[model samples]
Target: MKMVIVDKANEGKKLFRYIRTLAPSMKNGEIFMSIRKGKIKINNRIEDQGYILKNGDVVKIFFPDEIIKKYTDNDRNKYRSIDSNIDVIFEDKDIIVVNKPAGILVHPDRREFKKNLVESVKAYLYKKNEFKPGDYFTPSPCHRLDTNTSGLIIFAKTHFALQKISTLFRERNGDKLYLALVFGKISSSILISSSIDASENKENKVAVKEAHIHNFIPEKSKFIEENPTLSATYVRPLKYDSRLSLVEINLWTGKKHQIRASLAAALHPLIGERKYYTSQSLSLSQMLNVSNYYLHCYKLKINGYEEFKAPIPKKFSQILSEMFKIDAAKL
Candidate 1:
């Protein structure tokens, strides 16, 4: 909703400081720049952009819905129902593992996710397994990948597995292994740490800077307010094919997009990563056509037992055989 502020409400505070009380999500510096950028208006008049608010002064805070709106209603409910084609990987009494293809969402962002993995999994299990209508099938992905990313995913079939798995991640007992193809050759083991920023463009969000914390021009790097996440990764390079390499990465933390962001920050961006460029990498966008991301959860071990892996995805499978010349079918 557009905001109209009461006069004298802020007691003659600076324009940006006053606005912070109204829109707390915006940083003071950001609000100040928005005021300078002519984004803030006063009583429908573009007053001296620097005008401070006095008692009885009306302040119009312009929060463009475009900035507020990241997802649309029609788009939100698009993937509510899980498709029946989800590959059932492995199942025990406590959990179910499914092969999630890239591009399918793990859950509905709103009611309208076009292809929700959880809902689809629910519908499939109910219809095929004689699960009673509204039977309590708790839908929770033990871990997640980017919606555009595909591969093995685990769902807690029972609450016990969910709690155990969740705690496992918290205690760092369970870890995920991702198989990825990237544009450059990374020879030795390296630890990559990056402070990611969700910068926006006209179309979508862009993640920039590889710093421990992202600081833009003029903004000093603010110490990350959130707890500094601990991360460790073990990289095993299987084969190098001049332009790309087939590698397996074991993640030490479950941070959001850790592999993609960390690798990009290290100049070995994922082959198909369209963001966070290091200026020395190749663009895999043109070559990537698979539904999910080029990254795959190729292997998983909880409490140190590795049994589930759905062979390499097709796009990379062919690339693997042709580039490394290993018949993936034989693996």
Candidate 2:
């Protein structure tokens, strides 16, 4: 028998969703069966899986001891701890924004499960006594940046803030600006607006297909038809030489590899992007002696709320100095 109490963070959430977070090892079928068999009760009354939880509600579960043990034992200790010197860009009662460095993933995945930005945020909050283990809601990132893309990432400190910020991002109510160095000289500004279809190939790479009309729908994941979404990128050349051009990218719509794919389709890919466009002429690793790509989210703004900006990374400045004889600090 296990007893739990609803807290502020989980209030107004469905019973099934809260249970899954509590016991991740239990399958959906098992959870549904437990509800049907009266093995789970809310406020001493048998409730359906869709019942909305409220603060002060007592939840009781009756499960086998072995099943409970399976979920309780986690391998968090196996992962390496992140550095303590996390750069917090902004913080208020509702949210915390951090300046994430390059080569650090925003979240953990099966391929890379060790040090990640999310855990680092959690640890930072824990050290400040802002996060407690028994709290109903855990602070989490509202949006994500690519692993090699360095920039500002926001973390919601409360459940209300989380829901609000997530809705803002989903509705495209925010402005996101990035800086990138691409091959070839671009003299004029251009706008690339098209429908993007994305799917995982056999090599586990995200293959992107762009079209004026919606097409190329995959069976397992319908990337275009389901969402009916279109991606838009506005690019302006900031500096240009014979070989490379520094550009400012305004991302109007967010999608998987939208900027990288759009630029590559235009025959000017980012300088260090391997998956989108591998430059054979100038190896980024050989020149800069770094494996990270050269795309940075320099600025972000949420309407009527807050704005953030992150400084360009040192390696990016090094490339600019070596090629264009320009100082990044002056930009």
Candidate 3:
């Protein structure tokens, strides 16, 4: 018999749900038959499939050793090992925050089996003896950052922390500040209020539409009509050269590619943004020697928590110094 102990992650979940994680390759019919034939027991007693697991609960499986091995084998081998140079910004018993570099995916996708930030966080925790296979909860990112957008990514070390952080983001109680280098000089602060809808095209894209028709609506009528998926960004110009502007963006609503799409619609596409702004002449890589998009999540603040800041990347600083001829350290 193989024994398992419920941890905080799997606590409060249904027995079947926990079992699926343990034996993902096993069929539902096989699991049902095993339970019906007294092949599973909870705390030394046979429990129904709907049994609610709690912390410290014990589970016993009476399957052949080979079958159990097939079910419990760690799939970590399927992922590539991340670079050893990952940066840990903060860590505690409940959560960890890391500085995710640009060009690394935050999570795994079917298109790529390569290592991602989440897997890297798990591996980091493992080396510290804070995580292990079959633990009740594995450290996981509470939110995401686009592969090219570098900045602070939070990971929950415990399931409780995960739930709490997830709720905080869902309630929009967190503040996220991004810094971007755009193509044109923005003279003043402007609020970009628009409803963002998913593009009808197969490729993942978003369309931003202002609430009312321009000129037809009175200036006072600019109060944004409520939209279920309304996205708002407050852009404040920090510094600008004749050709490029550095702007600090306060993202009030999080949507897929909201910042990139919104800024592009406002005629200030982010430098090196190939998807939203396709102008070949505006390519920063060709003119300014910058290859990647110039957007970074520099700061994040959550309710009841102190603000966190990620230092601007060196390459970003290089572009600022080269193009604007200003000290990036000050910005």
**Total colliding residue pairs, candidate 1:** 24
Backbone clashes in model 3, listed as residue pairs? none
Question: Can you rank all candidates by lDDT, best first?
Answer: 3, 2, 1
- Give TM-scores for every candidate, taking all chains together and pairing residue i with residue i: 0.63, 0.78, 0.79
> How close is each model in CA RMSD to the real structure?
14.4, 6.3, 4.9
- The TM-score, computed over Cα atoms with residue i paired to residue i, of candidate 3 is 0.79
Worst 10 residues of 2 by lDDT: 212-221
How much is the lDDT of residue 269 in candidate 3?
85
Q: Give per-residue CA lDDT, model 2, range 1-331, as digits (tens).
A: 7889997777888988777756654679998999888899999898999999999899988877766665544412221244446889889999988989888888866584567887787667766777644345667899878888888888998888888888887776787888888877887777665666667676435444563321232331233244456676778888997767899887767788888888777667788777777564246444755455699888889975666888889989888888788888776
Q: Write the per-residue lDDT of candidate 1 for residues 1-331, one digit (tens) a residue.
A: 3565544324445665555434434556777777777677776666654576666666665656765332222222333333567788887666778888887888867666376787676656555663322222334688777787888888876545666787887666776778887767765544444545546567454353543422121111222123254333456677785666777887765666677777776666777666544444544545445223378887777884566777777876886776678776554
Question: lDDT for every model?
Answer: 0.62, 0.75, 0.76
Per lDDT, the best of the predicted structures is: 3
TM-score-wise, the better of 2 and 3 is 3
**Superposing every Cα of model 1 onto the true structure, what RMSD results?**
14.4
Cα RMSD for predicted model 2: 6.3
Q: Which parts of model 3 have CA positions greater than 4 angstroms off?
A: 3-62, 66-84, 211-228, 278-285
